[model samples]
Target: MTSRTAQNGGHYGAIVVGGGQAGLSASFHLSRAGIDHLVVEKKTAMHKWRDERWDAFCLVTPNWQCQLPGHPYDGDDPNGFMVKHEILGYLDRFKAKVKPPILEHTAVTAVERHAAGFRVETSAGSFTADAVILATSLYGTPSTPRAAERLPDDILQLHTVDYRSAEALPPGAVMVVGSGQSGAQIAEDLHLAGRKVHLATGNAPRCARFYRGREVVDWLWDIGQYNITIADDGMGKKRHDTNHYLTGRDGGRDIDLRRFAQDGMALYGRVKGVSGGRMLFEADLTSNLDAADRVYNGINALIDRHIAEKGIEAPPPSVYVPLWEPAEEPAELDLAAAGITSVIWATGFRPDWSFVGLPIFDGTGYPVQRRGVTAVPGLYVLGLPWLWTWGSGRFLGVAADAEHVVEHLTAAVAAPRQLMAQAG
Candidate 1:
């Protein structure tokens, strides 16, 4: 649904959809640059951060890295992690601080490229705008496999978004599918909380916990490690998610896995099917897990040299032990023996633009764009992971990208604007 059109008048210079970080960044820049724009958020203000996360959620990034354009977090723990509530409050205060024209609870239903610019439609109302920026994240929608539909009713299956805390779960053995960040973290939490856990494996990259006396993420920015993708080869794009550098799902960012396995969490390659009160799991997660382990060692060596050369001295980082040995091939997991009950599918998410029938999307259903600018003039995307490079899609990295988008947003529609002199 959409909100009613502005009471005073017509199309805004720009309209931004979704009020998440990406949208906030874009909107904030537009505001500072003196652009008239509206930020439309469908859910309750900061609903994504407030509801989507478990209470224990803390940003993997230290507060120092949580900087946005024109505003940064002001707190004692700049070097510490920002919890979900902190982030939500920060955004809330940021929104209040800026007070940009925002339409809350009003969702954008359609955006047809109009000859003038773009015709926007929302539950509130409709108007034409010079451009539209989709900062709504690609992860807003939860993805479920076709196999999930076939799972019998006896098995309680829920996506990671539905998961709040271990207490949200019903009592029973649980199969936590997908071993990516959320999958691994959730499995570890539930297992440690005393639920029997089975993790379905898939391809995952890994990372090191610390490098040269600091959290590895610090090195990611300080040394411009992820920036390496700016000069990436054709091979890098194909393996964006699989690439070894940042793909490292090292538990150092979340929770350690060596300790996770020690708690009796069962590992499997992948989940193939489900029937009765059971689901089937395979043995393929080992290769990706092993690859992550190898990379961790490689990171250690790099960090070691940095320490010696730079005279960096501090407590040693915890050594990452590979939790599971290399599984030769697939093996079927019997839920009975595994003591599996509810299945927490912590698999990742992607965009749900299916309802948005726009020609701007390419073969992969991803918008074709150079940076955030799309092939369709007056249409743009912001906050997409790897939109330009490995770091382009991250929260810390979006500021540089937001500048690029704002520049285009301002210059592209310089004409027909109601100048301050003209307005009076």
Candidate 2:
């Protein structure tokens, strides 16, 4: 391999930002290609998985999908989901397997074009590399609605990132906003902990954990759903769609909010805002519930069709029936009167690319990349949802995207040096 080492204290053929699974996956393939690279992480390699998630957090998908390059899920339970510590153990094992050169506790502040290739400014020091891989996962800045500020100053509010357990909150009812995967699961976690939970449902879809005698994810894998690319016709819009709410906690099961309501957990619609010290909600609870069920059944129907076409024998398909229905849609709730003392915003996050000193972005501020390769030469993005396929964001597909990006980068890095050597 040709060494095009630019004059700098920290230089490499490639510099990968973020030490999460995505970054490590890239380093794995880069090493295979014999490229001299370094993985720069803002925190320890397993920081996010260790610190960001709640105590009860587990993989919503099955464990078989945890496919990092050269290191597949070696756990005994492929069908079972790995909980918080188990997930950390898996990642730790993968890190050891790849043995990538990594610098932890280093925050990358900026990346701009440089004469050599790209100049990366970090807390530890500056680095020059022939290529840059922004391996930061899809989540960037935690986002809570502006209305959260209007709530009475006394009511404690926390985003999902800060939530550890229901017992950690002060003794009182907890209101969880957003019905996405995080919201629904956290609500269940709190409800199961004997805490009164008021969940504000969103438009996020839901799906069954097991369907037709098999896991829904396994069925989807058979149908090649995970392989679907963003470029597929009519699939581009799916990139922004909220993930289907389910659970892998306690083995695995569907998170049925209806049953929770029947058991006494209060349910509300999407939060509108706080006014006059009362939380206001849109009167769309019934519709949102129905919408989620529709998606749930729709997926089952897809699986049934796939089974029929392939002549695969499976149990009879079953549709979800609403166990409980709201008699009246409550539009407003006085926080103090309801004894609500804490609010958990599972409203999700927005990508922050302000540090990237480049114009390769869309109107939405999302990086414009074709399966990890950016428009700008030698700049790429890895570990983003829908980067190339549906699994790009998760452990299921980061490896493929990383391998593709590293292949393209290695060729680009070698070309200039090869030409320069011939000229000399």
Give the Cα lDDT of each candidate.
0.70, 0.90
Off by over 4 Å in 1: 1-9, 229-258, 302-330, 355-358, 415-424
Relative to the unseen true structure, what is the C-alpha lDDT of residue 352 in candidate 1, on a scale of 0 to 100? 71
Residue-level lDDT of model 2, residues 150-254, one tens digit each, is 999899999999999998999999999999999999999999999999999999999999998999999999999987899999988777889999999888999
The reply for model 2, stretches above 4 Å from the true place, is: 1-8
Residue pairs with clashing backbones, model 2: none
* Cα misplacement distance, residue 346 of candidate 1 (Å): 1.3
lDDT of 2: 0.90
The alpha-carbon deviation from the true structure for residue 398 of candidate 2, after best TM-score superposition, in angstroms, is 0.5
Clashes of 2: 0
Highest TM-score among the candidates is held by which one?
2
For 352-383, candidate 1 gives per-residue lDDT tens digits of: 76535468887777777777888776788888
Model 2: lowest-lDDT 10 consecutive positions: 1-10
